[model samples]
Target: MNNAVTLKGRTEGFQIILHASASFEEVVDQLKELTVQLKKDTQKGHELIFFVDTGNRLLSADEKKQISDIIEDEHFKISSYESDVISIEDAQKRAREARPKLEVRTVRSGQILEADGDLLLIGQVHPGGTVRATGSIFVIGELKGIAHAGFEGNENAIVLANFKYNAQVRIGGNVHVIENRDENLVQSEDIQFVYVNDLHIIEVGSLHYLKTIRPEIGKHSGGLF
Candidate 1:
């Protein structure tokens, strides 16, 4: 069998890395073998979280569901399963009213950071850097990279940036594409947040306005972390 899959234990949970270039059949075969190994190694009467880390490949919704079905059985009662596309800091952070804050000097090009819950970042997101989360994402500095929030289909997720017009911003299944910049267009200095409206359109507004318009937007139930 091809070594298309591997498992590693993370501080938050277990991560299963699937080779991006492997065929779907090869991945499935590896997963079957992995399940057997995991079942035998797992201690009796204990629960754990498992995450699927598809490095550069994006799994379709159907593919994700198939993986879930494979791991469902009597021996492995997975407390939670999630895509490692977004990073979850820790379950411990969920108990607090405040979210976990990541203070980075700079997220350089080709770097990626994922979170399972609300995340506060105090730094710059350079071009090509990526930030993804299952919940809201707050950037206190310039955002010049990609920011994806509500990764697990949470429509209420928001993306906040100190400056306007970052590289790209996507929330859930919606991509906020910017086009046709007027010759006189000017960047704003206001702190802004992006959220999906009820109409499914991505909207951008001042942070204060968003909070006032949707106070509930700030409220979020921590997903499996």
Candidate 2:
């Protein structure tokens, strides 16, 4: 019973380890006992964040809900659940989602181009056309149309284009209309990127600044510059 549920303190946070070989009922019973003891030892009105580690055990939705319901303390919150196993289909799907989708055709007027993950376009987006991505969007040609990044509510997503002097850019819930900018500077051949700043406002900066924002964007590519 002692081995059914174990609690350990780590630098990241407190961890509640569920025994891989223990029966669900036994684990629940031991967890209940430990929670009662912890409640008594802890000071009043203190919040506790715990990471639930299911070592080598995959829990169903109902099972996870059951454990959550059992830990019914207002001051106790479960930050996340960690499992050691993933299905092959899930792994494959993640791989696909991680890879950026690339297209080489112009997005004509009235057309809407979208990607599940990042989108890399080598053609221009005519006015009245729209390009949307669940992740980031990189345009090598003129972007005179609407560019919506993080369409799935990913605030960290960005938009990159050679020049977007007169276009609409959106990241998550924020939007920025590219207009009245220095036509000479913004119309340059060098790449410029658009992102959401700390204050949640849209910002357009040089390509070099992208490394500081998302270093991983250069993973498959040669370099950020």
Candidate 3:
């Protein structure tokens, strides 16, 4: 019997699902096309997510190389996967175990907070304020400064905010600075989160799932700024 591989795209990046009976070359070609399409869409102001299924086998050397090339070129972010194919239940358990838990309020200047779990900022993260985490960072108010997620080297971590006015942002060491903050900024009521998928750090809507499932108690009552 042949192996089957499935590729799926999400709001932040892509994943691969492997079944049985598929050619590695074909999968790589399809991924290339998907990357091109994603790039074009992003250029046009459209956001997308991606995923893949690798039934159960580890990626081939050549296939890994192709994926590495795409990631190096900044095509799209990569999320996560099992080192080996596991049962769906096992995968879910792994995901739950991998998620982080974090909390904060009133990020002041000259202060830095780092955590292995998701971070929640109830207020603004002021200029010169820095927060780093291995999971996702959520800000209920404005983000007027810098925030880094996936700090412990977990590329799957995310950073989220209600209003993005940050001078800089770093997710998994990928830095993005707002050169003209006065001109280019995102002002919206919606929550935003950044995560790494497919080797890229991408922003996406809300962290409702994380928040609901892994609620963190507030440690500091002050504002983050």
Candidate 1 segments whose C-alpha is farther than 4 A from its true place: 1-98, 178-181, 217-225
Best by TM-score: 2
* Ranking according to lDDT, highest score first: 2, 1, 3
Tens digits of per-residue lDDT for model 3, 1-225? 233445565556656564445676765666566566657666654444444456556776676667657643543545554454555765654454354444547778888877655666777778898887766677777687888876766665556665445456777778766444566445555665555545474545465664543344233233321
| Shift of residue 32 alpha carbon in model 1, Å | 32
Top lDDT prediction, candidate number: 2
lDDT agreement of model 3 with the native: 0.60
| lDDT measured at residue 204 in model 1 versus the true structure, 0 to 100 | 80
lDDT of each: 0.75, 0.86, 0.60
* Stretches of candidate 3 exceeding 4 Å from the true structure: 1-104, 179-186, 197-225
The backbone clash count of each candidate, in order, is: 4, 0, 52
lDDT tens readout by residue for model 2, 1-225: 348999999787689999989988999999999899999999999888889999988899999999998775799999899988776777765665677888999999999999887899999999999999988999988899999999989988999986545889999999888774765544556888989988999987888778988777747542222
Q: Write down the TM-score of every candidate.
A: 0.52, 0.69, 0.43
lDDT at residue 208 of model 1 (Cα atoms)? 65
**Alpha-carbon deviation at 136 in model 1, angstroms:** 0.5
Clashing pairs in 1: 87-114, 87-115, 87-116, 88-116
